[model samples]
Target chain A: MPAIEVRNLVKRFGSIVAVNGISLEIEYGEIFALLGPNGAGKTTTISILATLLKPTSGEAKINGYDVVKEAAKVRQSIGIVFQDPSLDDRLTARENLDIHGRLYHMSREERQRRIEEVLEMVELLDRADSIVKTFSGGMRRRLEIARGLMHKPKVLFLDEPTLGLDPQTRRHIWEYVEKLRDEGVTVLLTTHYMEEADYLADRIAIIDAGKIVAEGSPSELKDSVGGDIIKIKCSDAENMLKKLVSNGYDAMLVDDEIVIKAKEAEKMIPKIFAIADEEIKSITYKEPSLEDVFIHYTGKVFRDEEVDEIEASKMKWRMRR
Target chain B: MEDEKMISDIYAIYLREILRLWRQKVRLVTMIMMPLLWLGVIGNAFNSVMNLPTQGDFLSFLTPGILVMTMVFTATISGITTVFDREFGFLKEMLVTPIKRESILIGKMLGGVTQAVLQGILILILAIFMGVKFSGAMSIPGMFLTMFLVSIAFVSLGLAVASKITSMEGFQMVMNFMIQPMIFLSGAFYPTTFLPDWLKIMVKINPLTYGVDAMRYFAIGVNEFNIIADLLILLIFSITMILIGGHFFRKS
Candidate 1:
């Protein structure tokens, strides 16, 4: 059995279907990423699988235990670092991890040993005695990650692990996440950063508007955009797009530039110049990126707006409380 | 084994609250000072206007009420910590743990109760220092028992209200609207006998009325209702409030 199995999971909050029929299977020791813009249902899917929210339909299992029926067993096997800061800032780093250990029923000696190990793993042993309120944002994130690993869970879910961090801190967190895979731990993370997914994920599922638009390895997803992307800025771009389409080239007019998807763009460029009657201002071609892959599947550019629709929905949920 | 784990989980949550309380130095000073002010200022200020049907002084009559007031105030506002936890995201960390959700609620309620009872004891000591008389050494256990019952009931009620209130401002508004009426109507300031019948009905319905009356019986050798009846009503109130609070907490 897969380490994590989600079968057509659907979670609805009244009229809003937050998670719309999602399915996934993750094997042991692999780092998987759910790449999406905010409100793309990545966090909702993770919440369902972590047994924090009940699904409207379908099912999920962690370590072969049903998320709803065997939720206790599932909880025992999984650790989660939520998108928002969840540590009690008043407590010291060691205290926070100690609380997590006690919650998981670790013995006193085992908790002491594991606390040192996890804190050292996150390079926070020197700051273990310092109160979390005094730590910087990056340090807090690292401590939260350490606390999540306190119980030695089989699967760790990191929801926006390095969100709101500097480039150096983000890289440091990525390295720690990569280290988890070497320890034979399965990791499922969600992020909007294309490079984050590209650099760390063994496989990725590009989700949008509560649906998975595409899924593959980073290179495979880039390759799925069909080979190379060729953009030509030219006079009479409309005429150039018409000429390329009539000549059976896969082309589209984007912002006064003609974009073409061709395998061997260098060879296709000579043919394009031969066919085009319009004056070409400039021409550029490069291999497809994950951005290109996202645009290819969704037909829209990725917007990095800070307004999180999931947080808005959560506010509504809290209001209903 | 499951039961053992649940106990340890509850202990962890309970320990965190204790640690947080210890860290709030200002709150400790206020806890000690507030009772002194109430017993020293209000106990004397009200003595002139207040007349009791019993032989004891007004200060002695007011001591038990003040004790109950300490417990009620501390326990009820203790739920504000829950609202703060929710706002700051720490509650989510606790909720996702492997332990049963009810363990979290129980742990928090017990934590609030511990704080309340400790405050009540501090007030009791202050009341004695202010020349308030008690029945004897044996009354100490009954007084502690009454304080515990009052603490548990109000803490559960506070948490129940908190489970539905998402914001600290909203909770403060509701608590302000609820707490003062519960305190004033419970005969914490004056005797319930001289009040008009309609006002007496409100006093009869207040849970703190029984708790204060029971404590009064132990502290001042005075009895408004049967001690057995008072204890029974407080017991029933505590259990009912706990169930209601636990239900709301689990739902959230």
Candidate 2:
């Protein structure tokens, strides 16, 4: 059996069908990423698989245990790091891990030993005795990750693990996640960061509006869009687009820039200047990224959800905790 | 072995609440300070102006009433923490664990009862300094027993209300509207015998009235209602409230 299997899962919140008939299978010892923008149902799907929310229809299994029927076994097999911080602010880092260990019914000696190991794995041994309220945003997030690993779960779920963090901290979290995968732990993570999926995930699924638009390895997904992207910054982009298309070239205009797809962009670059004359100011060509693939499948740029002031403050409050 | 671990899980939740109460200075200070002001200012104001029922001073007669009121207030505050946990997402962490659901509510209810009883005892000790004696009508253990039962009932009552609300502000509004009327109808500040017929009927319907009546009998050897009947009423109220609270907690 696959390590994790989700078959036609559907979750509806009144009139809103957050997750609609999505299916996925993740093999053992694989680091899988569900890549999508906010409100794409990645979190909702993970919640159903983790047994935090029951599906309205269909089924999911973690380590061969049914998520809804054998929820206790599923809960015992999987660990989760939620999008929001879940650490108790008043407790020290060690105490928080200790409580989690107790809940999982780890013996006293094993609890003590595993707590130290997980703390060191997150590089938080020095601050283990301090209360969580005194830690920085990055430190608290690392501590939450450490707490989630205290139970030694077979499968781990990370929902937006490095959201709202600096570049250095995001890189730091990526190393620990890679280390977990190296130790043969199956990890399922959700994120919108294109570079993160490219750098870490062994397999990627691009989801939009509660459905998977495409699923493959990073290079495979990018290769699906076909050919290098050549973007020219010039005046009269609309006129240039029409000229290139009439000449049997796939070209389009995007925000004052003319873009074209070609198998050999090097040879195409000189031919493009012949049509432009003096209208071209600059030109650049690069391989298509996962972002381009997303646009290719959806026919639209990724539109980020707007965060209201109350939601922003709630995030700030959690970071403080 | 599984049973032992389950007990430890409950202990972890209980200790978490205790640590929170210790770190939160404002909650502890208010829990201690509220009863003192009530016993000092309100107890003194009624002493010289009003007639009393007990054989001693008005302060002595008012001590048990103050203890019961403190328990009720502290129990309500205890339940509000559940709403806070839900609002902040900490409750979700606890819910996703492998432990049983009933243990979560039981652990929380026990923590609330412990805090409420501790606050009630603190006031009882303070009352001794104001010349109220514990040996008046019941043994020291008897007074504590009555306090424990009343504390459990109120904590469960608070949990029942907390389970229905989602916000801290909303819980406070509901508590404010519910607590004052319960206090007045319990006859904490006056005797029910001298009241008019309708008011007496209101006191009879209030569950807290039996708790106060029982505590009054234990604290001063005086009975407004039968001792067995009062204790039974409080027992039935506690079980009913816990069932209601547990049902709502499972729904959430």
Candidate 3:
């Protein structure tokens, strides 16, 4: 049986439809990723599946338990790591995990054992005694992940688990996620980072405007975008895009850059330069990536430009507090 | 087995709240000291400034008022933890758990009651240093029981208010706006019998008035209103606030 099944799930906030008729299935022990840009309803979808938000219509089942009717069972089977920080900074890491275990009704002995095991699994046992407020961002994220695992949930939901982290820490979190998968824990993760999804997910579902635009394995999605992607930074990108399209090349303009997909992009680049020699200032060709697959399917550039702005405003608000 | 889990779920939330209270040393000190200051400064100021006929020492008469005031403020302020949890996202952590919703709400309310009761005890203890004595029909256990009932009622009111507020600063503003009027109008610093007709009506309407009056009847056995009637009103208010607060918290 699938670990999770979402059937036409819809969530509307007043006049706005945040998640509109979404559907997908995640198999047992599989590392599934929902990749989307900001406001693509990834977090909203995760919230519904985790039984935090009730769906406006349609249904979702977690571990064969209906999210709305058997919400308690769904909550029992799943653990969610929210995109925002949720740790009580005043509490020690161990205290935080202890509270979670107790909430799940684990005995003292069981709580102790599971807390230690998950703490060590996340490599946070060394800092378990210290208060969470004293920890760095990466350490806090690791501790949050450990807290989510303390209940031994069958399915773990990570909503942007490595968001706003440095490259090394992001890679470290990815390793822990891979380890969880090895232990047969079905993980449903959402990310806007194309490469994180490519590296971590067994299957990828690209969502845009609250709907799945594409779904496949990394290699399969990459192959679907043709052979190679040639990205060009030039003067008059609009003119460059028109010229490339008129010359029998499949190309599009994305955020002041021209991108083209061809069978042999390396050979086509020289001929393309022959047509718009002066306008093409810098030309770079690379093999197809999940990003190319996204642009190919969505017909628009996927950018999380609002993330940094939101983070900045949050920082300002915190400083004021 | 499931019943045992439900009990543990409530215990877990209660335990965390106690731990948080223990960790906040400054808050502990402030909650204790504020009431003592109110008792000492206000009791003396009223005694010397206003030579009111009828009582054996204004300090003794004022002790119950200060005790109730402390519980009211502490109880209401305790609800700010909910706002803090909501704003900081810790509430979401608890909400996502598989535990029953009633456990979470009741557990948090019990925790706040515990803290408010502790603050009330400290003030009652301070009454000893002020030369106030407990006597007449009200026993020491009875005073403690009155404080307990009053704490539950005010804390429920705080929780109901806190459930809707989003920010700590906003809650603080609400506390500032609501607390002064509630405390002053409740006859916490003076007898309601001597007040003007309009002010007496306002004091009668304030819920904390019955808490203070009953506490006075308990401490030094002075009765502004019938002790049994005061306790009955407090009981009704506590139940209603719990129902209302639980509804708001569940919706939140």
What is the C-alpha local distance difference test score of each model? 0.87, 0.85, 0.87
**Candidate 3, TM-score vs. the true structure?**
0.95
Tens-place lDDT per residue, model 3, B88-183, is: 789899989989989988788889999988998888788787777877474687788888888887777788888888777877787778877888
Quote the lDDT for A240 in model 3. Answer: 79
Give per-model TM-scores. 0.93, 0.94, 0.95
The candidate that wins on TM-score is 3
lDDT of 2 at B93: 89
Q: What local lDDT score does residue B188 receive in model 1, on the 0 to 100 scale?
A: 81
User: Model 2 off-target regions past 4 Å?
Assistant: A234-239, A253-257, A276-278, A305-314, A317-321, B1-5, B48-55, B136-138
- Superior candidate under lDDT, 2 versus 3: 3
Off by over 4 Å in 1: A234-237, A254-257, A270-282, A306-321, B47-53
* Model 2 / residue B165 / CA error / Å: 1.6
Candidate 2 lDDT over B149-240, as tens digits, reads 88777777777787887777877787678887888889787878889999989899998898888887888776688888988988888888
Q: Could you give the TM-score of chain B for each candidate, in order?
A: 0.95, 0.95, 0.94
Worst-scoring 10-residue span by lDDT in model 1 chain A: A312-321
Which prediction has the highest lDDT against the true structure? 1
